[model samples]
Target: MKKFYIKTFGCQMNVNDSEKMAGILRSLGYEKTDLPEEADLIIVNTCSVRAKPDNKAYSFIGNLKKIKKEKPETIIAVGGCVPQKEKESILRFKHVDLVFGTFNFMKIGELIKRAKKERVVEILNSKIPEEDKVPLIDSYLENPYVAYVTVQRGCNRFCSYCIVPFTRGRERSVKPELVLKEVKRLAERGVKEVHLLGQNVDFYNYEGIDLADLLYMVSEVEGIERIRFTTSHPCGFNRKIVEAMKNIEKVCPYVHLPPQSGSTKILERMNRGYTREEYTEKVMMLKEEIPKVALSGDFIVGFPGETTKDFEETLSLVETCVFDQGFVFEYSPRPFTKASNFKDDVPKEEKNRRLQELQNLLRVQAEEKNKKRLGCIEEVLVEGKSPKGKELSGRTKDNKLVVFDGSEELVGKFVEIEITETSPFFLKGKLLQKVKV
Candidate 1:
């Protein structure tokens, strides 16, 4: 049996992709290994969402040359966005035995078989293969309470700042029946939570079944205490989905809908397809439908032609929306993206200043939001003991982290915690009695 090791970086979708790859390799009699140095085959599942991740992938690939010197037979393969984007450059490295793209996962077994004979193989195909053979590997979830259930593969939105459209290819949804089957299997395996993964998750509409129906269907599955999905496009977030979040018992009230920018001008430039007013309306609708819902969002500061006023509009939206938590990032130009053709005009100092301001503003709001939970008893799925065993760390239904003193036996179970203390980042809780749902 060939021993292989795989390392994945970036979004949950990429993590699921890595799982599928591992499953494929396992079906081919390849056993997974933790140490890359000891493995006969090593795969680096790359991500290009941010410059830091791409830089890390490059650095890791460069370091592999040293490993190759010691173990010449070790097949070093690169896959995902980095391989899909930097096709020929990855081949420049002598140690890289294989380069495969995201869509070419079905061909992994064949690629490895060929690499043993040819020493070098690149399979970055333009079209996604028809086969939807999911991997059958033992899942390596960081927490047993939550498991990512991937319902779709890829994106259709060509947002100027995004590389997802290129790397993930066009939107191709999984069969709804198949998704239900996977969820059922996961339930049987003792998984309690299912977070549906996708780039534009709400856009999942196939064979008369929309994401709403899927949500309702998944909620019916036993053992799943909570269900959540992420990276929802504003254009795709409709009234039906908002209503589903409220009606579906297992569907958590937290939504990760990326508005990208608050300025309509910047949104238009980014090809985000929705205006600030439209995005705001979506938020309003969700709030009206699910009043208790805690909102989370993403923001990119300093796009190609972003101005101070444009940035202030963002701050204003954040103020108006009062998002529970937002992941703010300074715009980093990605190669081959539409925005890359525009002037990288946003000064680094200005970008940093805007990012800091956004962070500071959000910090204040987050602190206030957390304070609301001070006396409330929140349902938290105990993940595990924190780095400081002084408290256990778990996420509330709204996805807020609550650290409390709890028995290790309660790790995978859901327990109600009374929020006693709060911070902008986390809440200190007292494990109130565990209640049966």
Candidate 2:
């Protein structure tokens, strides 16, 4: 009858980790609660990928101090990237009873019990142990029809501006059999969509099976209607993967490749192995191989030594790629990143200006591309009701959001929709027919 509450920060990986922790708690007879104040145990899953998220995590934990004070017996735990990197530093918040690392969530049940008697701080070393490689089959799914399966962990490519390699450690892929087993189980449980996740997903290679082979294997799952992977490094992404996407019927035609910067000079400084030209080649390859591919990318507006010319090349790349979606961020130095040592010469004002300009360009491109989809029939996987509640919302195979009027029965089914209206962000559609999966 004990209740637990979790506040998750950062990307899909963090969300999946939180779900795994929740599953472990459930197995221990703990029910999840929405409000932290009402829970007997409170967990703050943190992220330190960027300064904004890092600061937000600390701020959230600070707020939880009051609940800990009001309920003296309440246990407060902090885990994820922040704890992985900061280690005991996170325990500076006296209210925090436990501090665990990125790979330590699998042991949450024991950690929670230990924290009850005394403060516990366990940060696993960089290398992921063999036992930790096993996929969490009991992970609680937020959406019954969709789930995130992490096939790989950590990053080997230590980009100058990135802190993932330090926080997540070296790249370690889950056994292909384990991944397939998890996917099959999820499919059996009514999951129609599985997003294969990793810090560098395209780098996934277990034994002899690569991401391409895994995609073909996942497609064989009877009830899995869609397979998508994310956060691919351009250097690791190859034609074989593109071919798998093209040949596999179940694989969605959406790839989130972060090209960091478009200028060769800035790219070199960032330690991103691929050049602007090489990055463009890969983008072109994806478009040529799969004409319907919807490309989303990440861009850092200003780095330590970025010049005006460097920023222009990035703008040029955005124009050339015409990304379906773009996540543009103003660069902030993070601890332990190589770029943090370099002089952050780009003024904050300049970083802001460049970010806005790049974002505007991406927005314009997205609007133009979305407008082209008007009147076209798209296959959409009905997720749930839209924010307005009157219409149902879902996503097309290419990952474009589509909203239309539909019954609740259509929540987990695939439907054909005729795009009636479009915007830079989403598409309004008319339900044409239910897809017989």
Candidate 3:
């Protein structure tokens, strides 16, 4: 079998794209290979979200240049947000055989065929792919219990500081029936958890049906014991979704709401639509509805117009909300984004200070949150062995990572674990009992 190696970067959305590409390659008799040197085809599924990841992609491609020189027959391809954004510049490296955009992954065979004759760069302008056009990958990294299904493609809200609107195009959703069919098929294959992915998942609407409706349908599928979606905007996170989390037993009580900044002025500068007060109100409402729900959020420090007071507001929000998980990032202006042209006035030193300060506060809050679960029991879906050690890793219903001793047979099963120890990132657990398979 012809072996293919792929390195994926960025979020779950990128992972889904890489899997889809793998499915297409598998159709052409290419088996997945861990080693890039042993592969006939090499692909880098990239992300252009921040400066660091963008630089990482560039550095990786630079290293791959040597690999191509030694093995001239190995075809190299780069696809996803980075290629979609960089376009012609990505082909500047002579080693890059083919480049495709986020929406054109299914055409891998044709792109490779064209690349053999000359450099081929195909970037689609549209957002969504035709239904059934993108192949479904049933397997991932030997984890058979969890899956990521793209309910929608692209974003409608073009936050001034973001490049997703340009690279991913507009919001286009998959049909609810199609999504349900995939979940059912996954259920039959023993999948227990399915996370519906999107640029802004709360915006998923096919006709009148929305994400809440989709979640209800997916939870009804035979083998799906846990349900989830991610990266929500406060605009569409209404009472329906809150109700879904409350009413549906299978739906996970975890939400990722990215309140970029807590200052209305900075939020306005970012063009994030909802006000700070509005976002806070929404969070409060959700908490009132689902008392035990755990929140994970995103924060950006040192926006173009952020003042000391604005930074304080962000810190205050973090303190007030006490997110179980906080993803903090220093703002890096991306190309073609409005903030890039708006003069990045936040000093490098100041930005670094703000990031560290925010992280320090969040760390204490996260530790406090984890410590609360010390004697409590939580149901966890056993994922697999941790890369760091021989301990088996699993996640709670609210998305808390727990490590404990277990066999490979427990990888895909749901287990109830008592929190024996707690840390900021994960918990040390003791084996309690196995739940439903």
Candidate 4:
């Protein structure tokens, strides 16, 4: 069988894209290979979200140059954001055989066929594929408990500091019935949890149904113990979603609603389409609905034109919201984004200082929040052995990672553990005397 390797970077959307690619390749009689060196094809599903991951992608591609030398017949393909963003430049690299974009993902095999004959093939601007057009893959690395179900593709929100709208294109959602069918199929295959993925998750609307209705439907499936969605935009989170989360027993008590900046002026410049007051109201209402819900957020520290006052407003929101976790980054210009057109005058040193300060304070808040979990019993979906194999790692309903010792047979089962210690990143636990169904 032909062997292939796919290395994915970026958000859950990219993960879902890679899975679709794997499925497509498998349908072509290809087998997934762990070692890139042993593969007939290598695919780097890239991300261009921030500067670091973009740099990482380039470095990875540079290394693959050697692999191409060792295996002259092996084809190297680049897909996703970086390829979509730098289509022509990517082809300049002698090692890159094909370049495809987010919309052109389904055309990978076609592009490879062309590359074999033409020596270079790039399909970065093909029309976006319909949701049902992509093949469903029997997973190469199947997890018993968790699956990422993508109900939608792309984004329309042109956040000034974001490149998603340009690279991922307009929002197009899959029908709710299709999503439920996929969830049911996953359940039949032993998946106990499904994390719905989208760039703007709450914006999912197919025909008349929205994300709230979708969550409610997925909750009804047998064998699905939990449901979660991520990368929610504050503007799209309506009361319906909040109420649905409260009423649905299977929806996890965890939300990652990103309030990029708390300052009204910065929000305006970012085209986030929501005010600080509006964001606060949504968070307050959700907390009222799901009292035990743990909140996480995304923050950008040094957006162009941000002042000290703007930075203070962000810090103030962090204090008021008390986020359990956050992904904080310094603003970096991306091609084709509105913000990239503005002067990037924020000093590098200042940006670094602001990001570090915000990170330090959040670490303190996270540690304090986690401390409260100590001595409490929480149910965990045992993932697998920790890196050392002496400990086991799993996640709680609040989406916190917990590690403890247990029998290897318990790896895929849900077990209750008594928390014994806490760290900013994870909770340490011991096997509880009782197990629940």
Candidate 5:
């Protein structure tokens, strides 16, 4: 039997995909290992969202090159967004035995069988592959309490600054019955939390079923205590999703709405298909519908034609929205994005300065908002031990991380935690007792 090590990078989708790949490899007698040195095959599941992740992929590949030299029989394969974007470039490294795209993993068992016979480079992903209905949260989950199910695949948005439409292709949703079947299996396995994943989750629609219907269906599954969905687009956020969050008791009161730029003009340039006021209107509606709802968003500073005034608009919007937590990005041109054709006029130094300023403001807001949770009691699902040890970590219903003293027996159970200390990023809490949901 051969051993394999997979270095997964980027979002939960990539994580799910990597886990699925491992499951596929199991039938071929390939066992997963922790160390690259101990494995006969090393797979680098990549990300290409920003410049940092893009560079990190090559840097890690370079390090792996040395390992390949020492042991020539070791096979190094690269998959995911980076390879989907730069298919031919990955083969430049002589040590790399295979290069595949995001949707090509279903054929990996066949690919690996062929690779053992000869060197192969497969980067052919021109169409959206048929999606597997089974949930990926099982077998490969780091935490038994939680799981991620991919309900949809690809994107059709074609936002000017985004490469998702090119790399992932058009959006298509999984059947609601299939989604419910997977959730039912997870419930049977004692999984308490289920997170439905997609590029733009709100746009999910299939056979008279949408995201809201899927959420309601999953909530009906026995032993399923919570449901969450992520990476929703501001343009597609409609009343159905808001109603789901309000009526469905198991649905978490959290939404990650990515408003690329706060300035309407910059947003228009990005082809986001929504205005600043429109985005805030949706956020406001969600809050009004569910008062305790935690709002998080995304921002991109120093876009192609952004001016100082435009950046100030973003800052002003941030102050107005007061996001519970948000992410700020410095624009980087992607190969198939419309921004690539325009001159990247924003000076790198200026972009960095703006990014720092935006992040600083968001940090202050996050700390101030977190302070409100200091005396509040939150229900958190115990996931696993903390990285520093002697402490256990879990997440609140709204997706806030809370750490406390706990035993391994409490790993998959829910406990009421009194917020003792509040940091900008997470909360320190004390568990009262485990509760039955």
Candidate 6:
């Protein structure tokens, strides 16, 4: 009858980790609660990718101190990237009963037991063996029809501005058999879509089996109607992966390649291993191979020593690529990253200005591209109801969000929709027909 609450921050990887932890807690007879103060245990799953999220995690953990004092028996745990990087320093909050790291979620039961007795901190500094990594748990999926299965962990590419390699350790791929096994199990449980996750998902390789092979293998699983993978590094993404996406019927034609910056000089300074020309070449390859492919990219506006010319080059890249979606961020140095050592010469106001300009350009491009989809019929997998309205919502194969009128019976099924209205962010559609699988 005990209740537990988990507050998660940052990306899909962190969300998956939190789900695994929730599953572990459920197995220990703990029910999840939305209210932190009402729970017997409260967990703050943190992220340190950006200064905003990193500071937010601290603020959240600080506020939990009051709940800990109000309920003396409440157990407080802190886990994820922040704890992985900060280690025992997270315990400075005093009320934190247990602190675990990115690689230590499998030991949650043991840690919680020890925390009940005394304070405990467990941050594994080395690679975790395959048997010890977090397993796919069906119980904690927020969406029954969609799931995120992490096929790889950590990052070998230590980009100058990233904290992932420091917090998550080196790249380690889950065995292909293990990944396929998890995929089959998810399909059997009625999951229609699976998103393979990693810091750099295209870098996934177990033995000689690569991400492209994994895609083909996953497609063979019956009932798995769609497969998507994310956060690919352009340097590691290859033609074979693009071919897999083209040949496999189930593999969604969407790629989230983080270009980071468009200027080759800025890219070199950031330790991103590809030139702007090379990155665009890859983008062109994806577009040529999968004509319907929806391209998503990440851009950092103001890195150390970035100039007006460098910023202009980035704007040109965005303009040329015309990404269907673009996530623009102002560069903020992180602890242990090489970029932190360089002088942060860009003024805050200038960084903000560049960010706004880049964002405006991206928005214009997105709206222009989305407007082209009007009246087109899109195959959408109904994930659930829209958060903003009464309409049912789902995503197309290329990851475009479509909302339309539908019954609850349509939640787990695929349907064809005629794009009626479009915005930079999502598409409003009319349900045309139910797709017979």
Clashes of each: 0, 0, 0, 0, 0, 0
- Using lDDT as the measure, the top candidate is 2
Worst 10 residues of 5 by lDDT: 131-140
Candidate 2 on 1-437: residue-level lDDT in tens? 99999999999999999988998899899999999999999999999989999989889999988998899899999999998888756978999999999988888999999999999999988457763456454788878889999888889888998999988888888887788888988988899999999999999988888999999988998889999998799999999999999999899999999998989999999999989999999999999999889999999988988999999999999889879999999999988999989998999999999999999999999999999999999999999999788899999999999999989999999999999999999999999899865
Q: How far is each candidate from the true structure, as Cα RMSD in Å? A: 2.2, 1.4, 1.5, 1.7, 1.7, 1.5
Q: Quantify all predictions' global Cα lDDT against the true fold.
A: 0.84, 0.91, 0.87, 0.86, 0.86, 0.90
Higher lDDT: candidate 5 or 6?
6
- Is candidate 2 or 4 superior in lDDT? 2
**Candidate 2 least-lDDT 10 residues:** 126-135
Error of 2 at 45 (Å): 1.0
**Clashing pairs for predicted structure model 4, backbone only:** none
TM-scores for every candidate against the unseen true structure: 0.93, 0.97, 0.97, 0.96, 0.96, 0.97
**Residue 281 in candidate 5 has what lDDT?**
88
lDDT of 6 by residue, 60-124 (tens): 99999899889989999999999898876687899999999988887788899999999999988
Q: Is candidate 2 or candidate 6 better by lDDT?
A: 2
Instruction: Tell me the TM-score of model 1.
Output: 0.93
RMSD (Cα, Å) of candidate 6?
1.5
Q: Candidate 5 lDDT (Cα, whole model)?
A: 0.86
Q: Any idea what lDDT model 3 has?
A: 0.87
User: What are the per-residue Cα lDDT tens digits for candidate 1 across 255-304?
Assistant: 98888788999999999999999999989889988988988889999899
What are the runs in model 2 whose C-alpha is more than 4 Å off? 131-135, 388-390
Model 5 agreement with the true structure over 1-437: per-residue lDDT tens digits:
89999998888889888877887777578888999998898989999888788889889998997888889888888899888888766878778888889877767777776777787777766645556533343345666678888888889878888887777778988878778887888778789999999999998889778888888888888899999998899877898899988999999999999887889999999999999999888888988898888889888988999999999999988887778898999999988788889889999999999999999998898899899998899898988898787899999998898999988888888899999999889999988988764
Q: Positional deviation of 146 in candidate 4, in angstroms?
A: 0.8
